[model samples]
Target: MQGDVFQADEHGPAEQPGERLLLDLDGFEGPLDVLLALAREQKVDLAKLSILKLADQYLEFVARVRQHHLDLAAEYLVMAAWLAYLKSRLLLPEPEPEPGEQPTAAEMAEILAFRLRRLEAMQSAGTALMVRPQLGRHFFARGEPEGIVVVTRSLYDVQLFDLLKAYADHVVRTSVRTLHIEAPDLYSVEDALRRLERMLGRMPDWSVLSSYLPAILGDPLKMKSAIASTFIAALELAKQGRVQLRQDGGPYSPIYIKAGGVAA
Candidate 1:
């Protein structure tokens, strides 16, 4: 009875098995699934393909299937009912909406379309998962087989006296003998003073302290100790007024020395 109200076109081409089910109109010939997808994606003009016409075609399809004595699926009937309800809602005049009120007919249609698209996406994902290679069936994990391991440990039994004896022997073998040899004092302050006095007696004019050093000491190894002792001796002689010390340039310049009023 519902099919009679929304019947298919008698002049349309005959349906064939294993062929895509399409809604054949005067200017449009496409599957309803494709139309819904285009609508959801906003790729096609909804004004060109009317919703009322789509619902009519779907009902007509149901009618055609019934004519062939084929049992209709529950989902087909559900979709037909939904299409009819959507059509009625779209056709009727909408009332003014209040604040925080229910959605309008157009909004409800958009929500339904969104839900259908989500369902389609879930189905596509499920199909992809089903076709993917499963573990153990397609391929097995590669790994080396487990094996038993054997470990050998060595133990030594000894007495306290033997342990002490071994420790004493190790210490005796590794112990180092440190010899401290005392180096004799090769040069002294008194010797440096005696030498400087003898040199000053011969040279009456001012001369650099370095000139006096070569006459007093010669060994390179004793140079550091000799220089230190000579400087100390010079200071003592200066304090005693035996020699005069002066630097013409700056603090870092060579020390100029001459015999003072007191002869050393």
Candidate 2:
């Protein structure tokens, strides 16, 4: 029913054997499609199709195509080779397994059947989806104007710069002065030494160095000058035995200048 009678092989007709009728397959997508068509015509289940017979049919079909000198796709030839390999592997005797070991699961017929079943499942799914309702086909969406919210402005409203200037004025008025205002740097080391001597002469003999520093150094600038001058004066006084400077803690600790034999 599928193809005209050309010749007969050992099997009565192309449809009688494990193979299918010799139909023109130039329009078929691939070998699988041809196989599926044959299975459908013969009312055979793809999962239960005979692997050896199927391979034989495919090779026979290829030979017929070659005989007719029809232009063949490389994929068809490749499928022919694969079927030949499957036929050989299926016909071969199973190898004996070692003791306590199972045989390999790489059987050719099982793999081909599994793949064919999967293809059939996919084809059925595609057919079902083709009849289902799709978007932009069965129904159309309503169209409406996109609404945009806009705000109205008044002529009396203040601008961005006005708000910024108000904030700046508030900051300047409420800010506390952290800067230390000090006297000029007119006094030299000698001037500082003289000022320290006057303060020391009036204080006790063992007065703390830090106690007299505040009185001798009037401001931050004077304090800077007095520190350098006082260090030199203390060194000189200690060298001359007029005063002794001793620390209360470790390095960089508080120092106390005590009067020695000398008066001031």
TM-scores vs. true structure, each candidate: 0.33, 0.39
lDDT scores of the candidates, listed in order:
0.67, 0.67
lDDT of 1 at 174: 89
Q: What is residue 108's positional error in candidate 2, in angstroms?
A: 1.0
Best by TM-score: 2
> Clashing residue pairs, candidate 1?
none
> In model 2, which runs have C-alpha deviations exceeding 4 angstroms?
1-26, 97-106, 143-264
Model 1 RMSD in angstroms: 22.4
Point out where model 1 deviates above 4 Å. 1-54, 70-75, 98-102, 143-264
**How does residue 4 of candidate 2 score in lDDT?**
31
State each model's C-alpha RMSD to the native.
Answer: 22.4, 16.5
